[model samples]
Target chain A: MLALGVAFSYTAGWLAPSRLSAQRIVDALQQNAGWHPGYRRNHAKGVCVSGYFESNGAAAAYSVARVFAQGRTPVIGRLAIPGGNPAAPDDSSPVRSLALRFDLPGGEQWRTGMNNMPVFVVATPQAFYEQLLAARPDPATHKPDPARLAAFFAAHPETGPFLAWAKTTRPSASFATQSYYGLDAFYFIDAAGRKHPVRWRVAPETADHTDAPAGPPSKDDLTDDLDRRLAQGPLRWHLLVTLGAPEDPTNDATRVWPAERPTIDAGTLVIEHAQDQASGPCRDVNYDPTVLPHGIAISDDPLLAARASAYADSYRRRTGEEAHVPGSAPAADATKASQP
Target chain B: MNTHPAFHPLARVLHWTMAVLILAMLFIGVGMVSTVSSKHTWLLAIHKPLGIAILVLAIIRLGVRLRFRAPPLPADMPASMQWVAHASHWVLYALMFAMPLIGWAMLSAGGYPVTILHGWPLPPLVPAHGALFGWLRLAHGVLAYVFFLAILGHMGAALYHGLIRRDDVLPSMSFPRREPSPPQMSDAPATTQASAVGTALPEQPPEAQPAGDPASPGQGDAG
Candidate 1:
């Protein structure tokens, strides 16, 4: 009875910080770096390595034995403009790209490539590139040419729903309440410890268009909106299962993951507070498929594999940085090892 | 060792190395901000340490400046222009040091971990606090923009000398040359004690300001 009470209190404390003063956090860290409670609740009701990363992390459960167990891991995430295009409109709803890094608690380190999009657009590498190119500029206009849509449709016929969502004017029109879909299908493990392919989506309650995408709002409206939403309350996601129902395993990304329903409620995705994702801290982050914990993986989604390859290439080319990190990486030369 | 008692070897070397480093840092900083990939993190890893190292070098450079006097300007150069150059150089030095120091301070204040390449973590030099960090961050950002502009002017002057005027001033300061000094026609050294400092032509030089001098009037600092 006493043990149950202690566990319940610890879990409650984990869910909500009764008090958040320097006094509370410092006291918590000193007591045990908050690990005593943090670890005990590592698999907290709805948490699955997502909390470690500000956004999402590699579900390293499949290959690496390093991050096999639970522990407080070092990680990072970035909020950025998506589509790899520098000129993309800033006001496109779902303000910034959140790339989460999870330094696994016990051993392995993984980084999950996540977005608000549950189902990704394409499955194969070739299709992925085709879609990406199609989404880019028109030679004459030198802007995101609308005619490229036909090329995308011709090459990757399965991007129906994705194109539908991407083409929706509301997302572009409404600046405040924007939803960013990872668009790429990834896998996840259910609370029952069963493997189920899933798509992670960041559904910002306040992210639709408070104003037009071209409104007089600052270019940082997306960031400001995200910050506001996070401050208001924990940002949440509706986990929709993409596998185990009618979705076939091993088929390329060209086909769809037949929807699974009743979509088992796996867990909630939440961002705690106003984490300043800036250039100094966020620039070196990666999104890899091999960074999962114990019960999730790439789901044979060619899109996941292709994304990993695309990200790795772009990551290496742009910054000369490696993407596949093994484990905990605290910045070097700091006298303060842990933040505590 | 040239026409004028130019910048010493150490000062010259530090100036050029910092220039290269700062240019690289700014380009990388700008590139890092626009992308969405692991590269962003990679660039930051470089930016943070390079920034810290620049701060250290700036400190050393400051001590050197305070301890030693820079060589006198060319006697033929205008006194007002020389004073402006001197003042601007000092401001540049101050900016060089302050930008990095403020960056580190901002990181410390914002609760972001500050690290050097040393195997150990950097000590939190400032007390960890949120609001303080925000102010420091704002200061660092504003100063970075200011520094960028200063660098632009500094480089513009250099390019003007190197490209347009075809003068040796830019090369002398930017790159090393150990040739013998031009023989002094006058008994006294230029820009010192009794020698005249202003151009022989008076305030508005009928010919022009020196090749390496700031072309604009307002840009001349109040020495």
Candidate 2:
């Protein structure tokens, strides 16, 4: 019985009392990948794009970051599907993601990775690791154990809202119509050194196009649709920031701030052109959200630092694979490169 | 057998106010669970404060009931129907008070603070507990359905009295008009209707009962 307990813990990735390392978490994510080697641990398949972000100067009230200055800043963005397999079909994934790097004046940069999901599934980094473990496929069945998943869910009641949301939220017909939300909170420091916690999301100007095709969606449906739409006009998303109220739970990404809290329209992110990652300017970029300009700093949210560490680990691993096999699968992999 | 003895002006006012608020609350409650859009946030803003309003008014309405006699049920009404009327009114009172409290406790157990008027926060009514939160949420939802059914039943009965029966039952708890009662009023009925109207009028002082004035609108009705 004691040995059985040890085996269960080992398989579940709860390596005793020590806090989970970034590598351990990333490895668990990779284990979820099906038939994909050296792919991004998460959101591997995506289309890179060129864009510019115009700040409305409203965000300046919360943060003294120069990135929020009222000007057009060059941007490299990637729209992605939520999965670890680079070759997975677009519609196979339920959540769509947006990762961006904004070039600022004075050689600084601001980076962010967002998802169409309003809230993340787990609250803490440990809980997230456990979730990955619970989702891992059984070696024999090649599917996650239903009993394990149920046990994990029962333990994490905080996941209730997110699970409820996933069932009801409609899949977007086009990337242009999907609103991308940053699942973690960050602290913005004003000139007075006062800090305010904020979470932000990009709301598309176009209404939600939730009418998914009745049948199997084409493999490149999102990318193809976005490219064709860009030919008509530039797609725009508004940067809306909700300031946290006093009782707002900043540490938990699963809980949403009360809607009545004041929101500031930070500006607009305009996607001008869609490009494949192969030769796109954003090809070599890593949108680690912790890479912030002045006046923006990490909050006490444990998930933020965990994400930063995991992103660093992912970037190094992917780049190492590239170095090992230069130009080997460039054409096939570039269109579905590790993006978010 | 069909007579109109107006409800106390306070009861009428409370009924109408609560009616609009409860309907709005039900829709907002439904909307809160159905979407994660910005509109959902607006619904919550209206939902929390509005629930508190209903809870507060239900208490005040119950307290005011002590000062006056409720109008009698129709002489020809079935005994079972009369019993349902009394039972449903108490159920409405209980549910109106309980829904907000349950919602408050549910949010509290879920570790969410209820916000009012901008950002004014209400203290949690219960400790944060997942199982308790789930149970309270389920209870709140179930009771809402019961509350809705009771409201429908109440409204149907009112319509039957007003439109089909042409009785004064509907007017008893609604805005009183100057029209003479369709059925001849007895002494007790006349004074009760007069007092109900007096309470309904915003300009009339509720405390202005004249000594030795049995017909004064300020005089409390005898059951």
Which residue segments of model 2 deviate by more than 4 Å?
A1-19, A34-38, A325-340, B1-223
- List model 2 lDDT by residue over B158-186, tens digit each: 66755665444566666443455545343
Output the TM-score of candidate 2: 0.54
Interface RMSD of each: 20.2, 20.4
Q: Candidate 1: give its CA RMSD in angstroms.
A: 20.2
* Displacement of the residue A40 alpha carbon in candidate 1, Å: 32
Candidate 1 — which residues are off by over 4 angstroms? A1-118, A122-340, B1-4, B35-41, B105-142, B156-223
Every candidate's DockQ is: 0.01, 0.00
The alpha-carbon root-mean-square deviation between model 2 and the true structure, to one decimal in Å, is 22.7
The candidate that achieves the highest TM-score relative to the unseen native structure: 2
How does chain B score by TM in each prediction? 0.71, 0.77
